[model samples]
Target: MLSANEIEQVYWLADSLGEPGQRIDDGLFLARVAMHARELPRNLRRFLADFRASNRSPACLVLGYPVDEVRMGPSPTACNRLREKTIDEIRLEIAAILISSCLGDVFGWRLQHEGSIIHDLAPRPEHEDVGLGTGSRQHINWHTEDSFHPYRADYVGLFCVRNSHRVATTIGALDPDQLSKRHRRLLSAPLFTFRPDPSYLMSKAHPLPGTDRGGILFGDPENLCLRFDQDYIDWPDDIDGIAEAVETLRRVIEASLIHMPLRSGDFLLLNNRRAVHGRPAFTPTYRGTDRWLKRINITRNLERSRRRRQSDFDRVIYV
Candidate 1:
């Protein structure tokens, strides 16, 4: 949470941008935000440092940030049309980017949400169960964000613009200590594959074809990373044990899942590789008063995805 003084500082910095809805390069925007980060209160800086380096937890919540009341209009019902941004939205996105820069560099994908650097999370009636953010009524089963892609985010950041209904976001982490030796061994094997979600295919004319294949868990046993999507993964027909193990894992996660409802001014950061997040079924009023949230993906290193990138200037991954 930022203090009133800190909030004023942020507002001043955002106002210095001169105009609302102006497009800024990622490098320039990050540099400007980083410069002002030094002015942040001591406790806020320490919290950002500790949270970015910590390995024990997969998610954390921040409270008490300030949101503009008059400028922020009703929530939109779609993710496309990225040119529109309100004064409040601009300030919120800048604030979010500052916090995320502590974790890593933020990025986008060409085949996801129209290559939006900052994506919207609003209920779209036409797509309620399409494996996308707009799927509000259908249970958005737990899965690592962009689990189908090799260049998935290292950290996922979300800022709640408005959530009057208190829509809860569910999250769960994998603990190696609880898994049996056999289950761990099976999960570490390269027997699992995840197909790209439907939303990615819809973003392109002729989408790339291929499934992401890898182990479900990786790294040290004490602190492992997970890559699983209940709706996207599939195992070999002959490998019945893997299937059973996955089902058991699913039940275990459900039993230990935590529900976090983000209110106005609430910001959350989740380790994308180590945690799975989802949302339960909810009714959307479709009236401009529906719940709204802004989201972005971050990576610790940009060079790791160079091969998948189209050009040096283009940050959005194509493959």
Candidate 2:
């Protein structure tokens, strides 16, 4: 529960960027905006309380206000000047907000591009092509992000700045209360593998460095942890056991799906371990006014445990 003043500040910040034709760099703008937004003592306490109540489990929580209220522009360059500020300024602002918001210490931030040039950014191909274009109509299968990575994100955040199509929907599959006993049993078994997609081998001109050919189905059965990509998984030749396991996971995902339509000014944060998320395919109009989302991968209190730090140059890796 954010205080009235803190909530007002968030609305004001969004309103500032809502002007037409603004080319604001999301990373820089968020960093500065967070400075003012993070100073509310009451709000900080509320955030800590909520986080503790949830057992520090990662889930989507929207701050400030909704997109319709903010009315931000459709252009990406609207606030470019704001983003051009010094890196130290940006870092300081972001760090302050996270600390005040009880989001734990800042770990890292990233700028993701969903255009033709950078389609396959993650190492796993099954997680590819999910970002909706301006107007495409493809339904993405629900799955985790780089579940194959030994150090997957503990938390993932997406802040929407612009959306022209207005039809992109992010769906998640994970509902503890709704899971069936059969689904639970299937998830409890170990019968899955992770391998680099064949396309990456040819493009990179070499084999992927950290791929595991015979990965298990569930990493932590009691916790019911899942890492699945229907498109990328290679089931063992002995099909009966593996098929049953895969089907069970699929049914559970279908049964527990949750849909979220993100708009500008809305930030969706989720626990990567507890939920598998994906978007329906959307066609990008490619017109200057296209759907653009700024993504930031975070590791809350788990940052120190993971021993990771934010990198200065945000590199785009094609996997």
Candidate 3:
């Protein structure tokens, strides 16, 4: 949580960006945000630095930031959101970018939202029962985000622009003690498969590294790292005890499920590799009033992940 003065400082910085949409692809935009990030409250900066250093937990929550609700107007519908969005709606994005830049380099996918650096999470009427960030009538299965990709985000940053419904974001991490020795070995072996998420398959992009069979767990003890997707994995019944092991893993994760109901001005940085996240079903009002959030993906380094892009300034990956 930020003090009154700290909150004011954040707004001051966001205001300077002035309709950040124009600067999303420019190097200056990131540089300026990094500058803003450096000047964040000393305590907040320390906390972010620590969060980046530690791999123990799956989440870090920062609260009491500022949102320009009055100027933002109604929550945008999925159909014309981008067509009518104004400067006020993007102020929160600038703030989110600034704070997230403190942890790592921000990035986005070419196939997702046409390479927009910031993404939106809001319910769409047509996809109420579908498995998407825009769905509101079905439970989104918990999984490591973009689990199929090798270049997946190191952290998933979500900023609650306006969540009147108080929807809960599901969170769970493996606890080594909860698993039996046999199950740990089973899950650690390379016997699982993951399919790319639907959002990434909207358009025909280049053939990227296909998610061949891989282990669910990583690291020496195999408890610290995990890659899982309940809906997108291919089930191979040939492997012995694979089904039982997965079932056991599911039970353990369910037992540790943590539901976080975020409010406006809340920013949550979720460690994509260390934890799995999803959300429960909620009813949405079509009156331009629904739970809304600004989202971004960040990686540890820029140059390391920069590959196959058209130019150095282009952050979106085509492959």
> What is residue 12's positional error in candidate 3, in angstroms?
0.9
Lowest lDDT sum, 10 consecutive residues, model 2, at: 115-124
Question: After superposition, which runs of candidate 1 have C-alpha atoms over 4 Å from their true positions?
Answer: 24-27, 31-38
List the candidate 2 regions with Cα displacement exceeding 4 Å: 1-4, 8-41, 48-58, 65-139, 175-190, 196-209, 213-222, 300-319
Candidate 3 TM-score versus the reference? 0.92
In candidate 2, what are the lDDT values of residues 1-319, reduced to their tens digit? 3456765655454444334443233435434444544444555557655853563253656554444422333334221323332332233223333433354322331222321111211112232343322223445566665565554555555555555467444555544435555655644454455654323333333324346543433444445555666666666666445566566667767776766666655555666666677666654444445555544544444434333323332222322
Q: Candidate 1 clash total?
A: 0
TM-score of 1: 0.92
Report lDDT per candidate.
0.77, 0.46, 0.80
Clashes by residue pair, model 3: none
Model 3, which residues run further than 4 Å from truth? Answer: 19-21, 25-27, 79-84, 204-209, 220-223
Any idea what lDDT model 3 has?
Answer: 0.80
User: Model 2 misses residue 217 by how many Å?
Assistant: 6.1
Query: In angstroms, how far off is 149's CA in candidate 2?
Result: 0.3
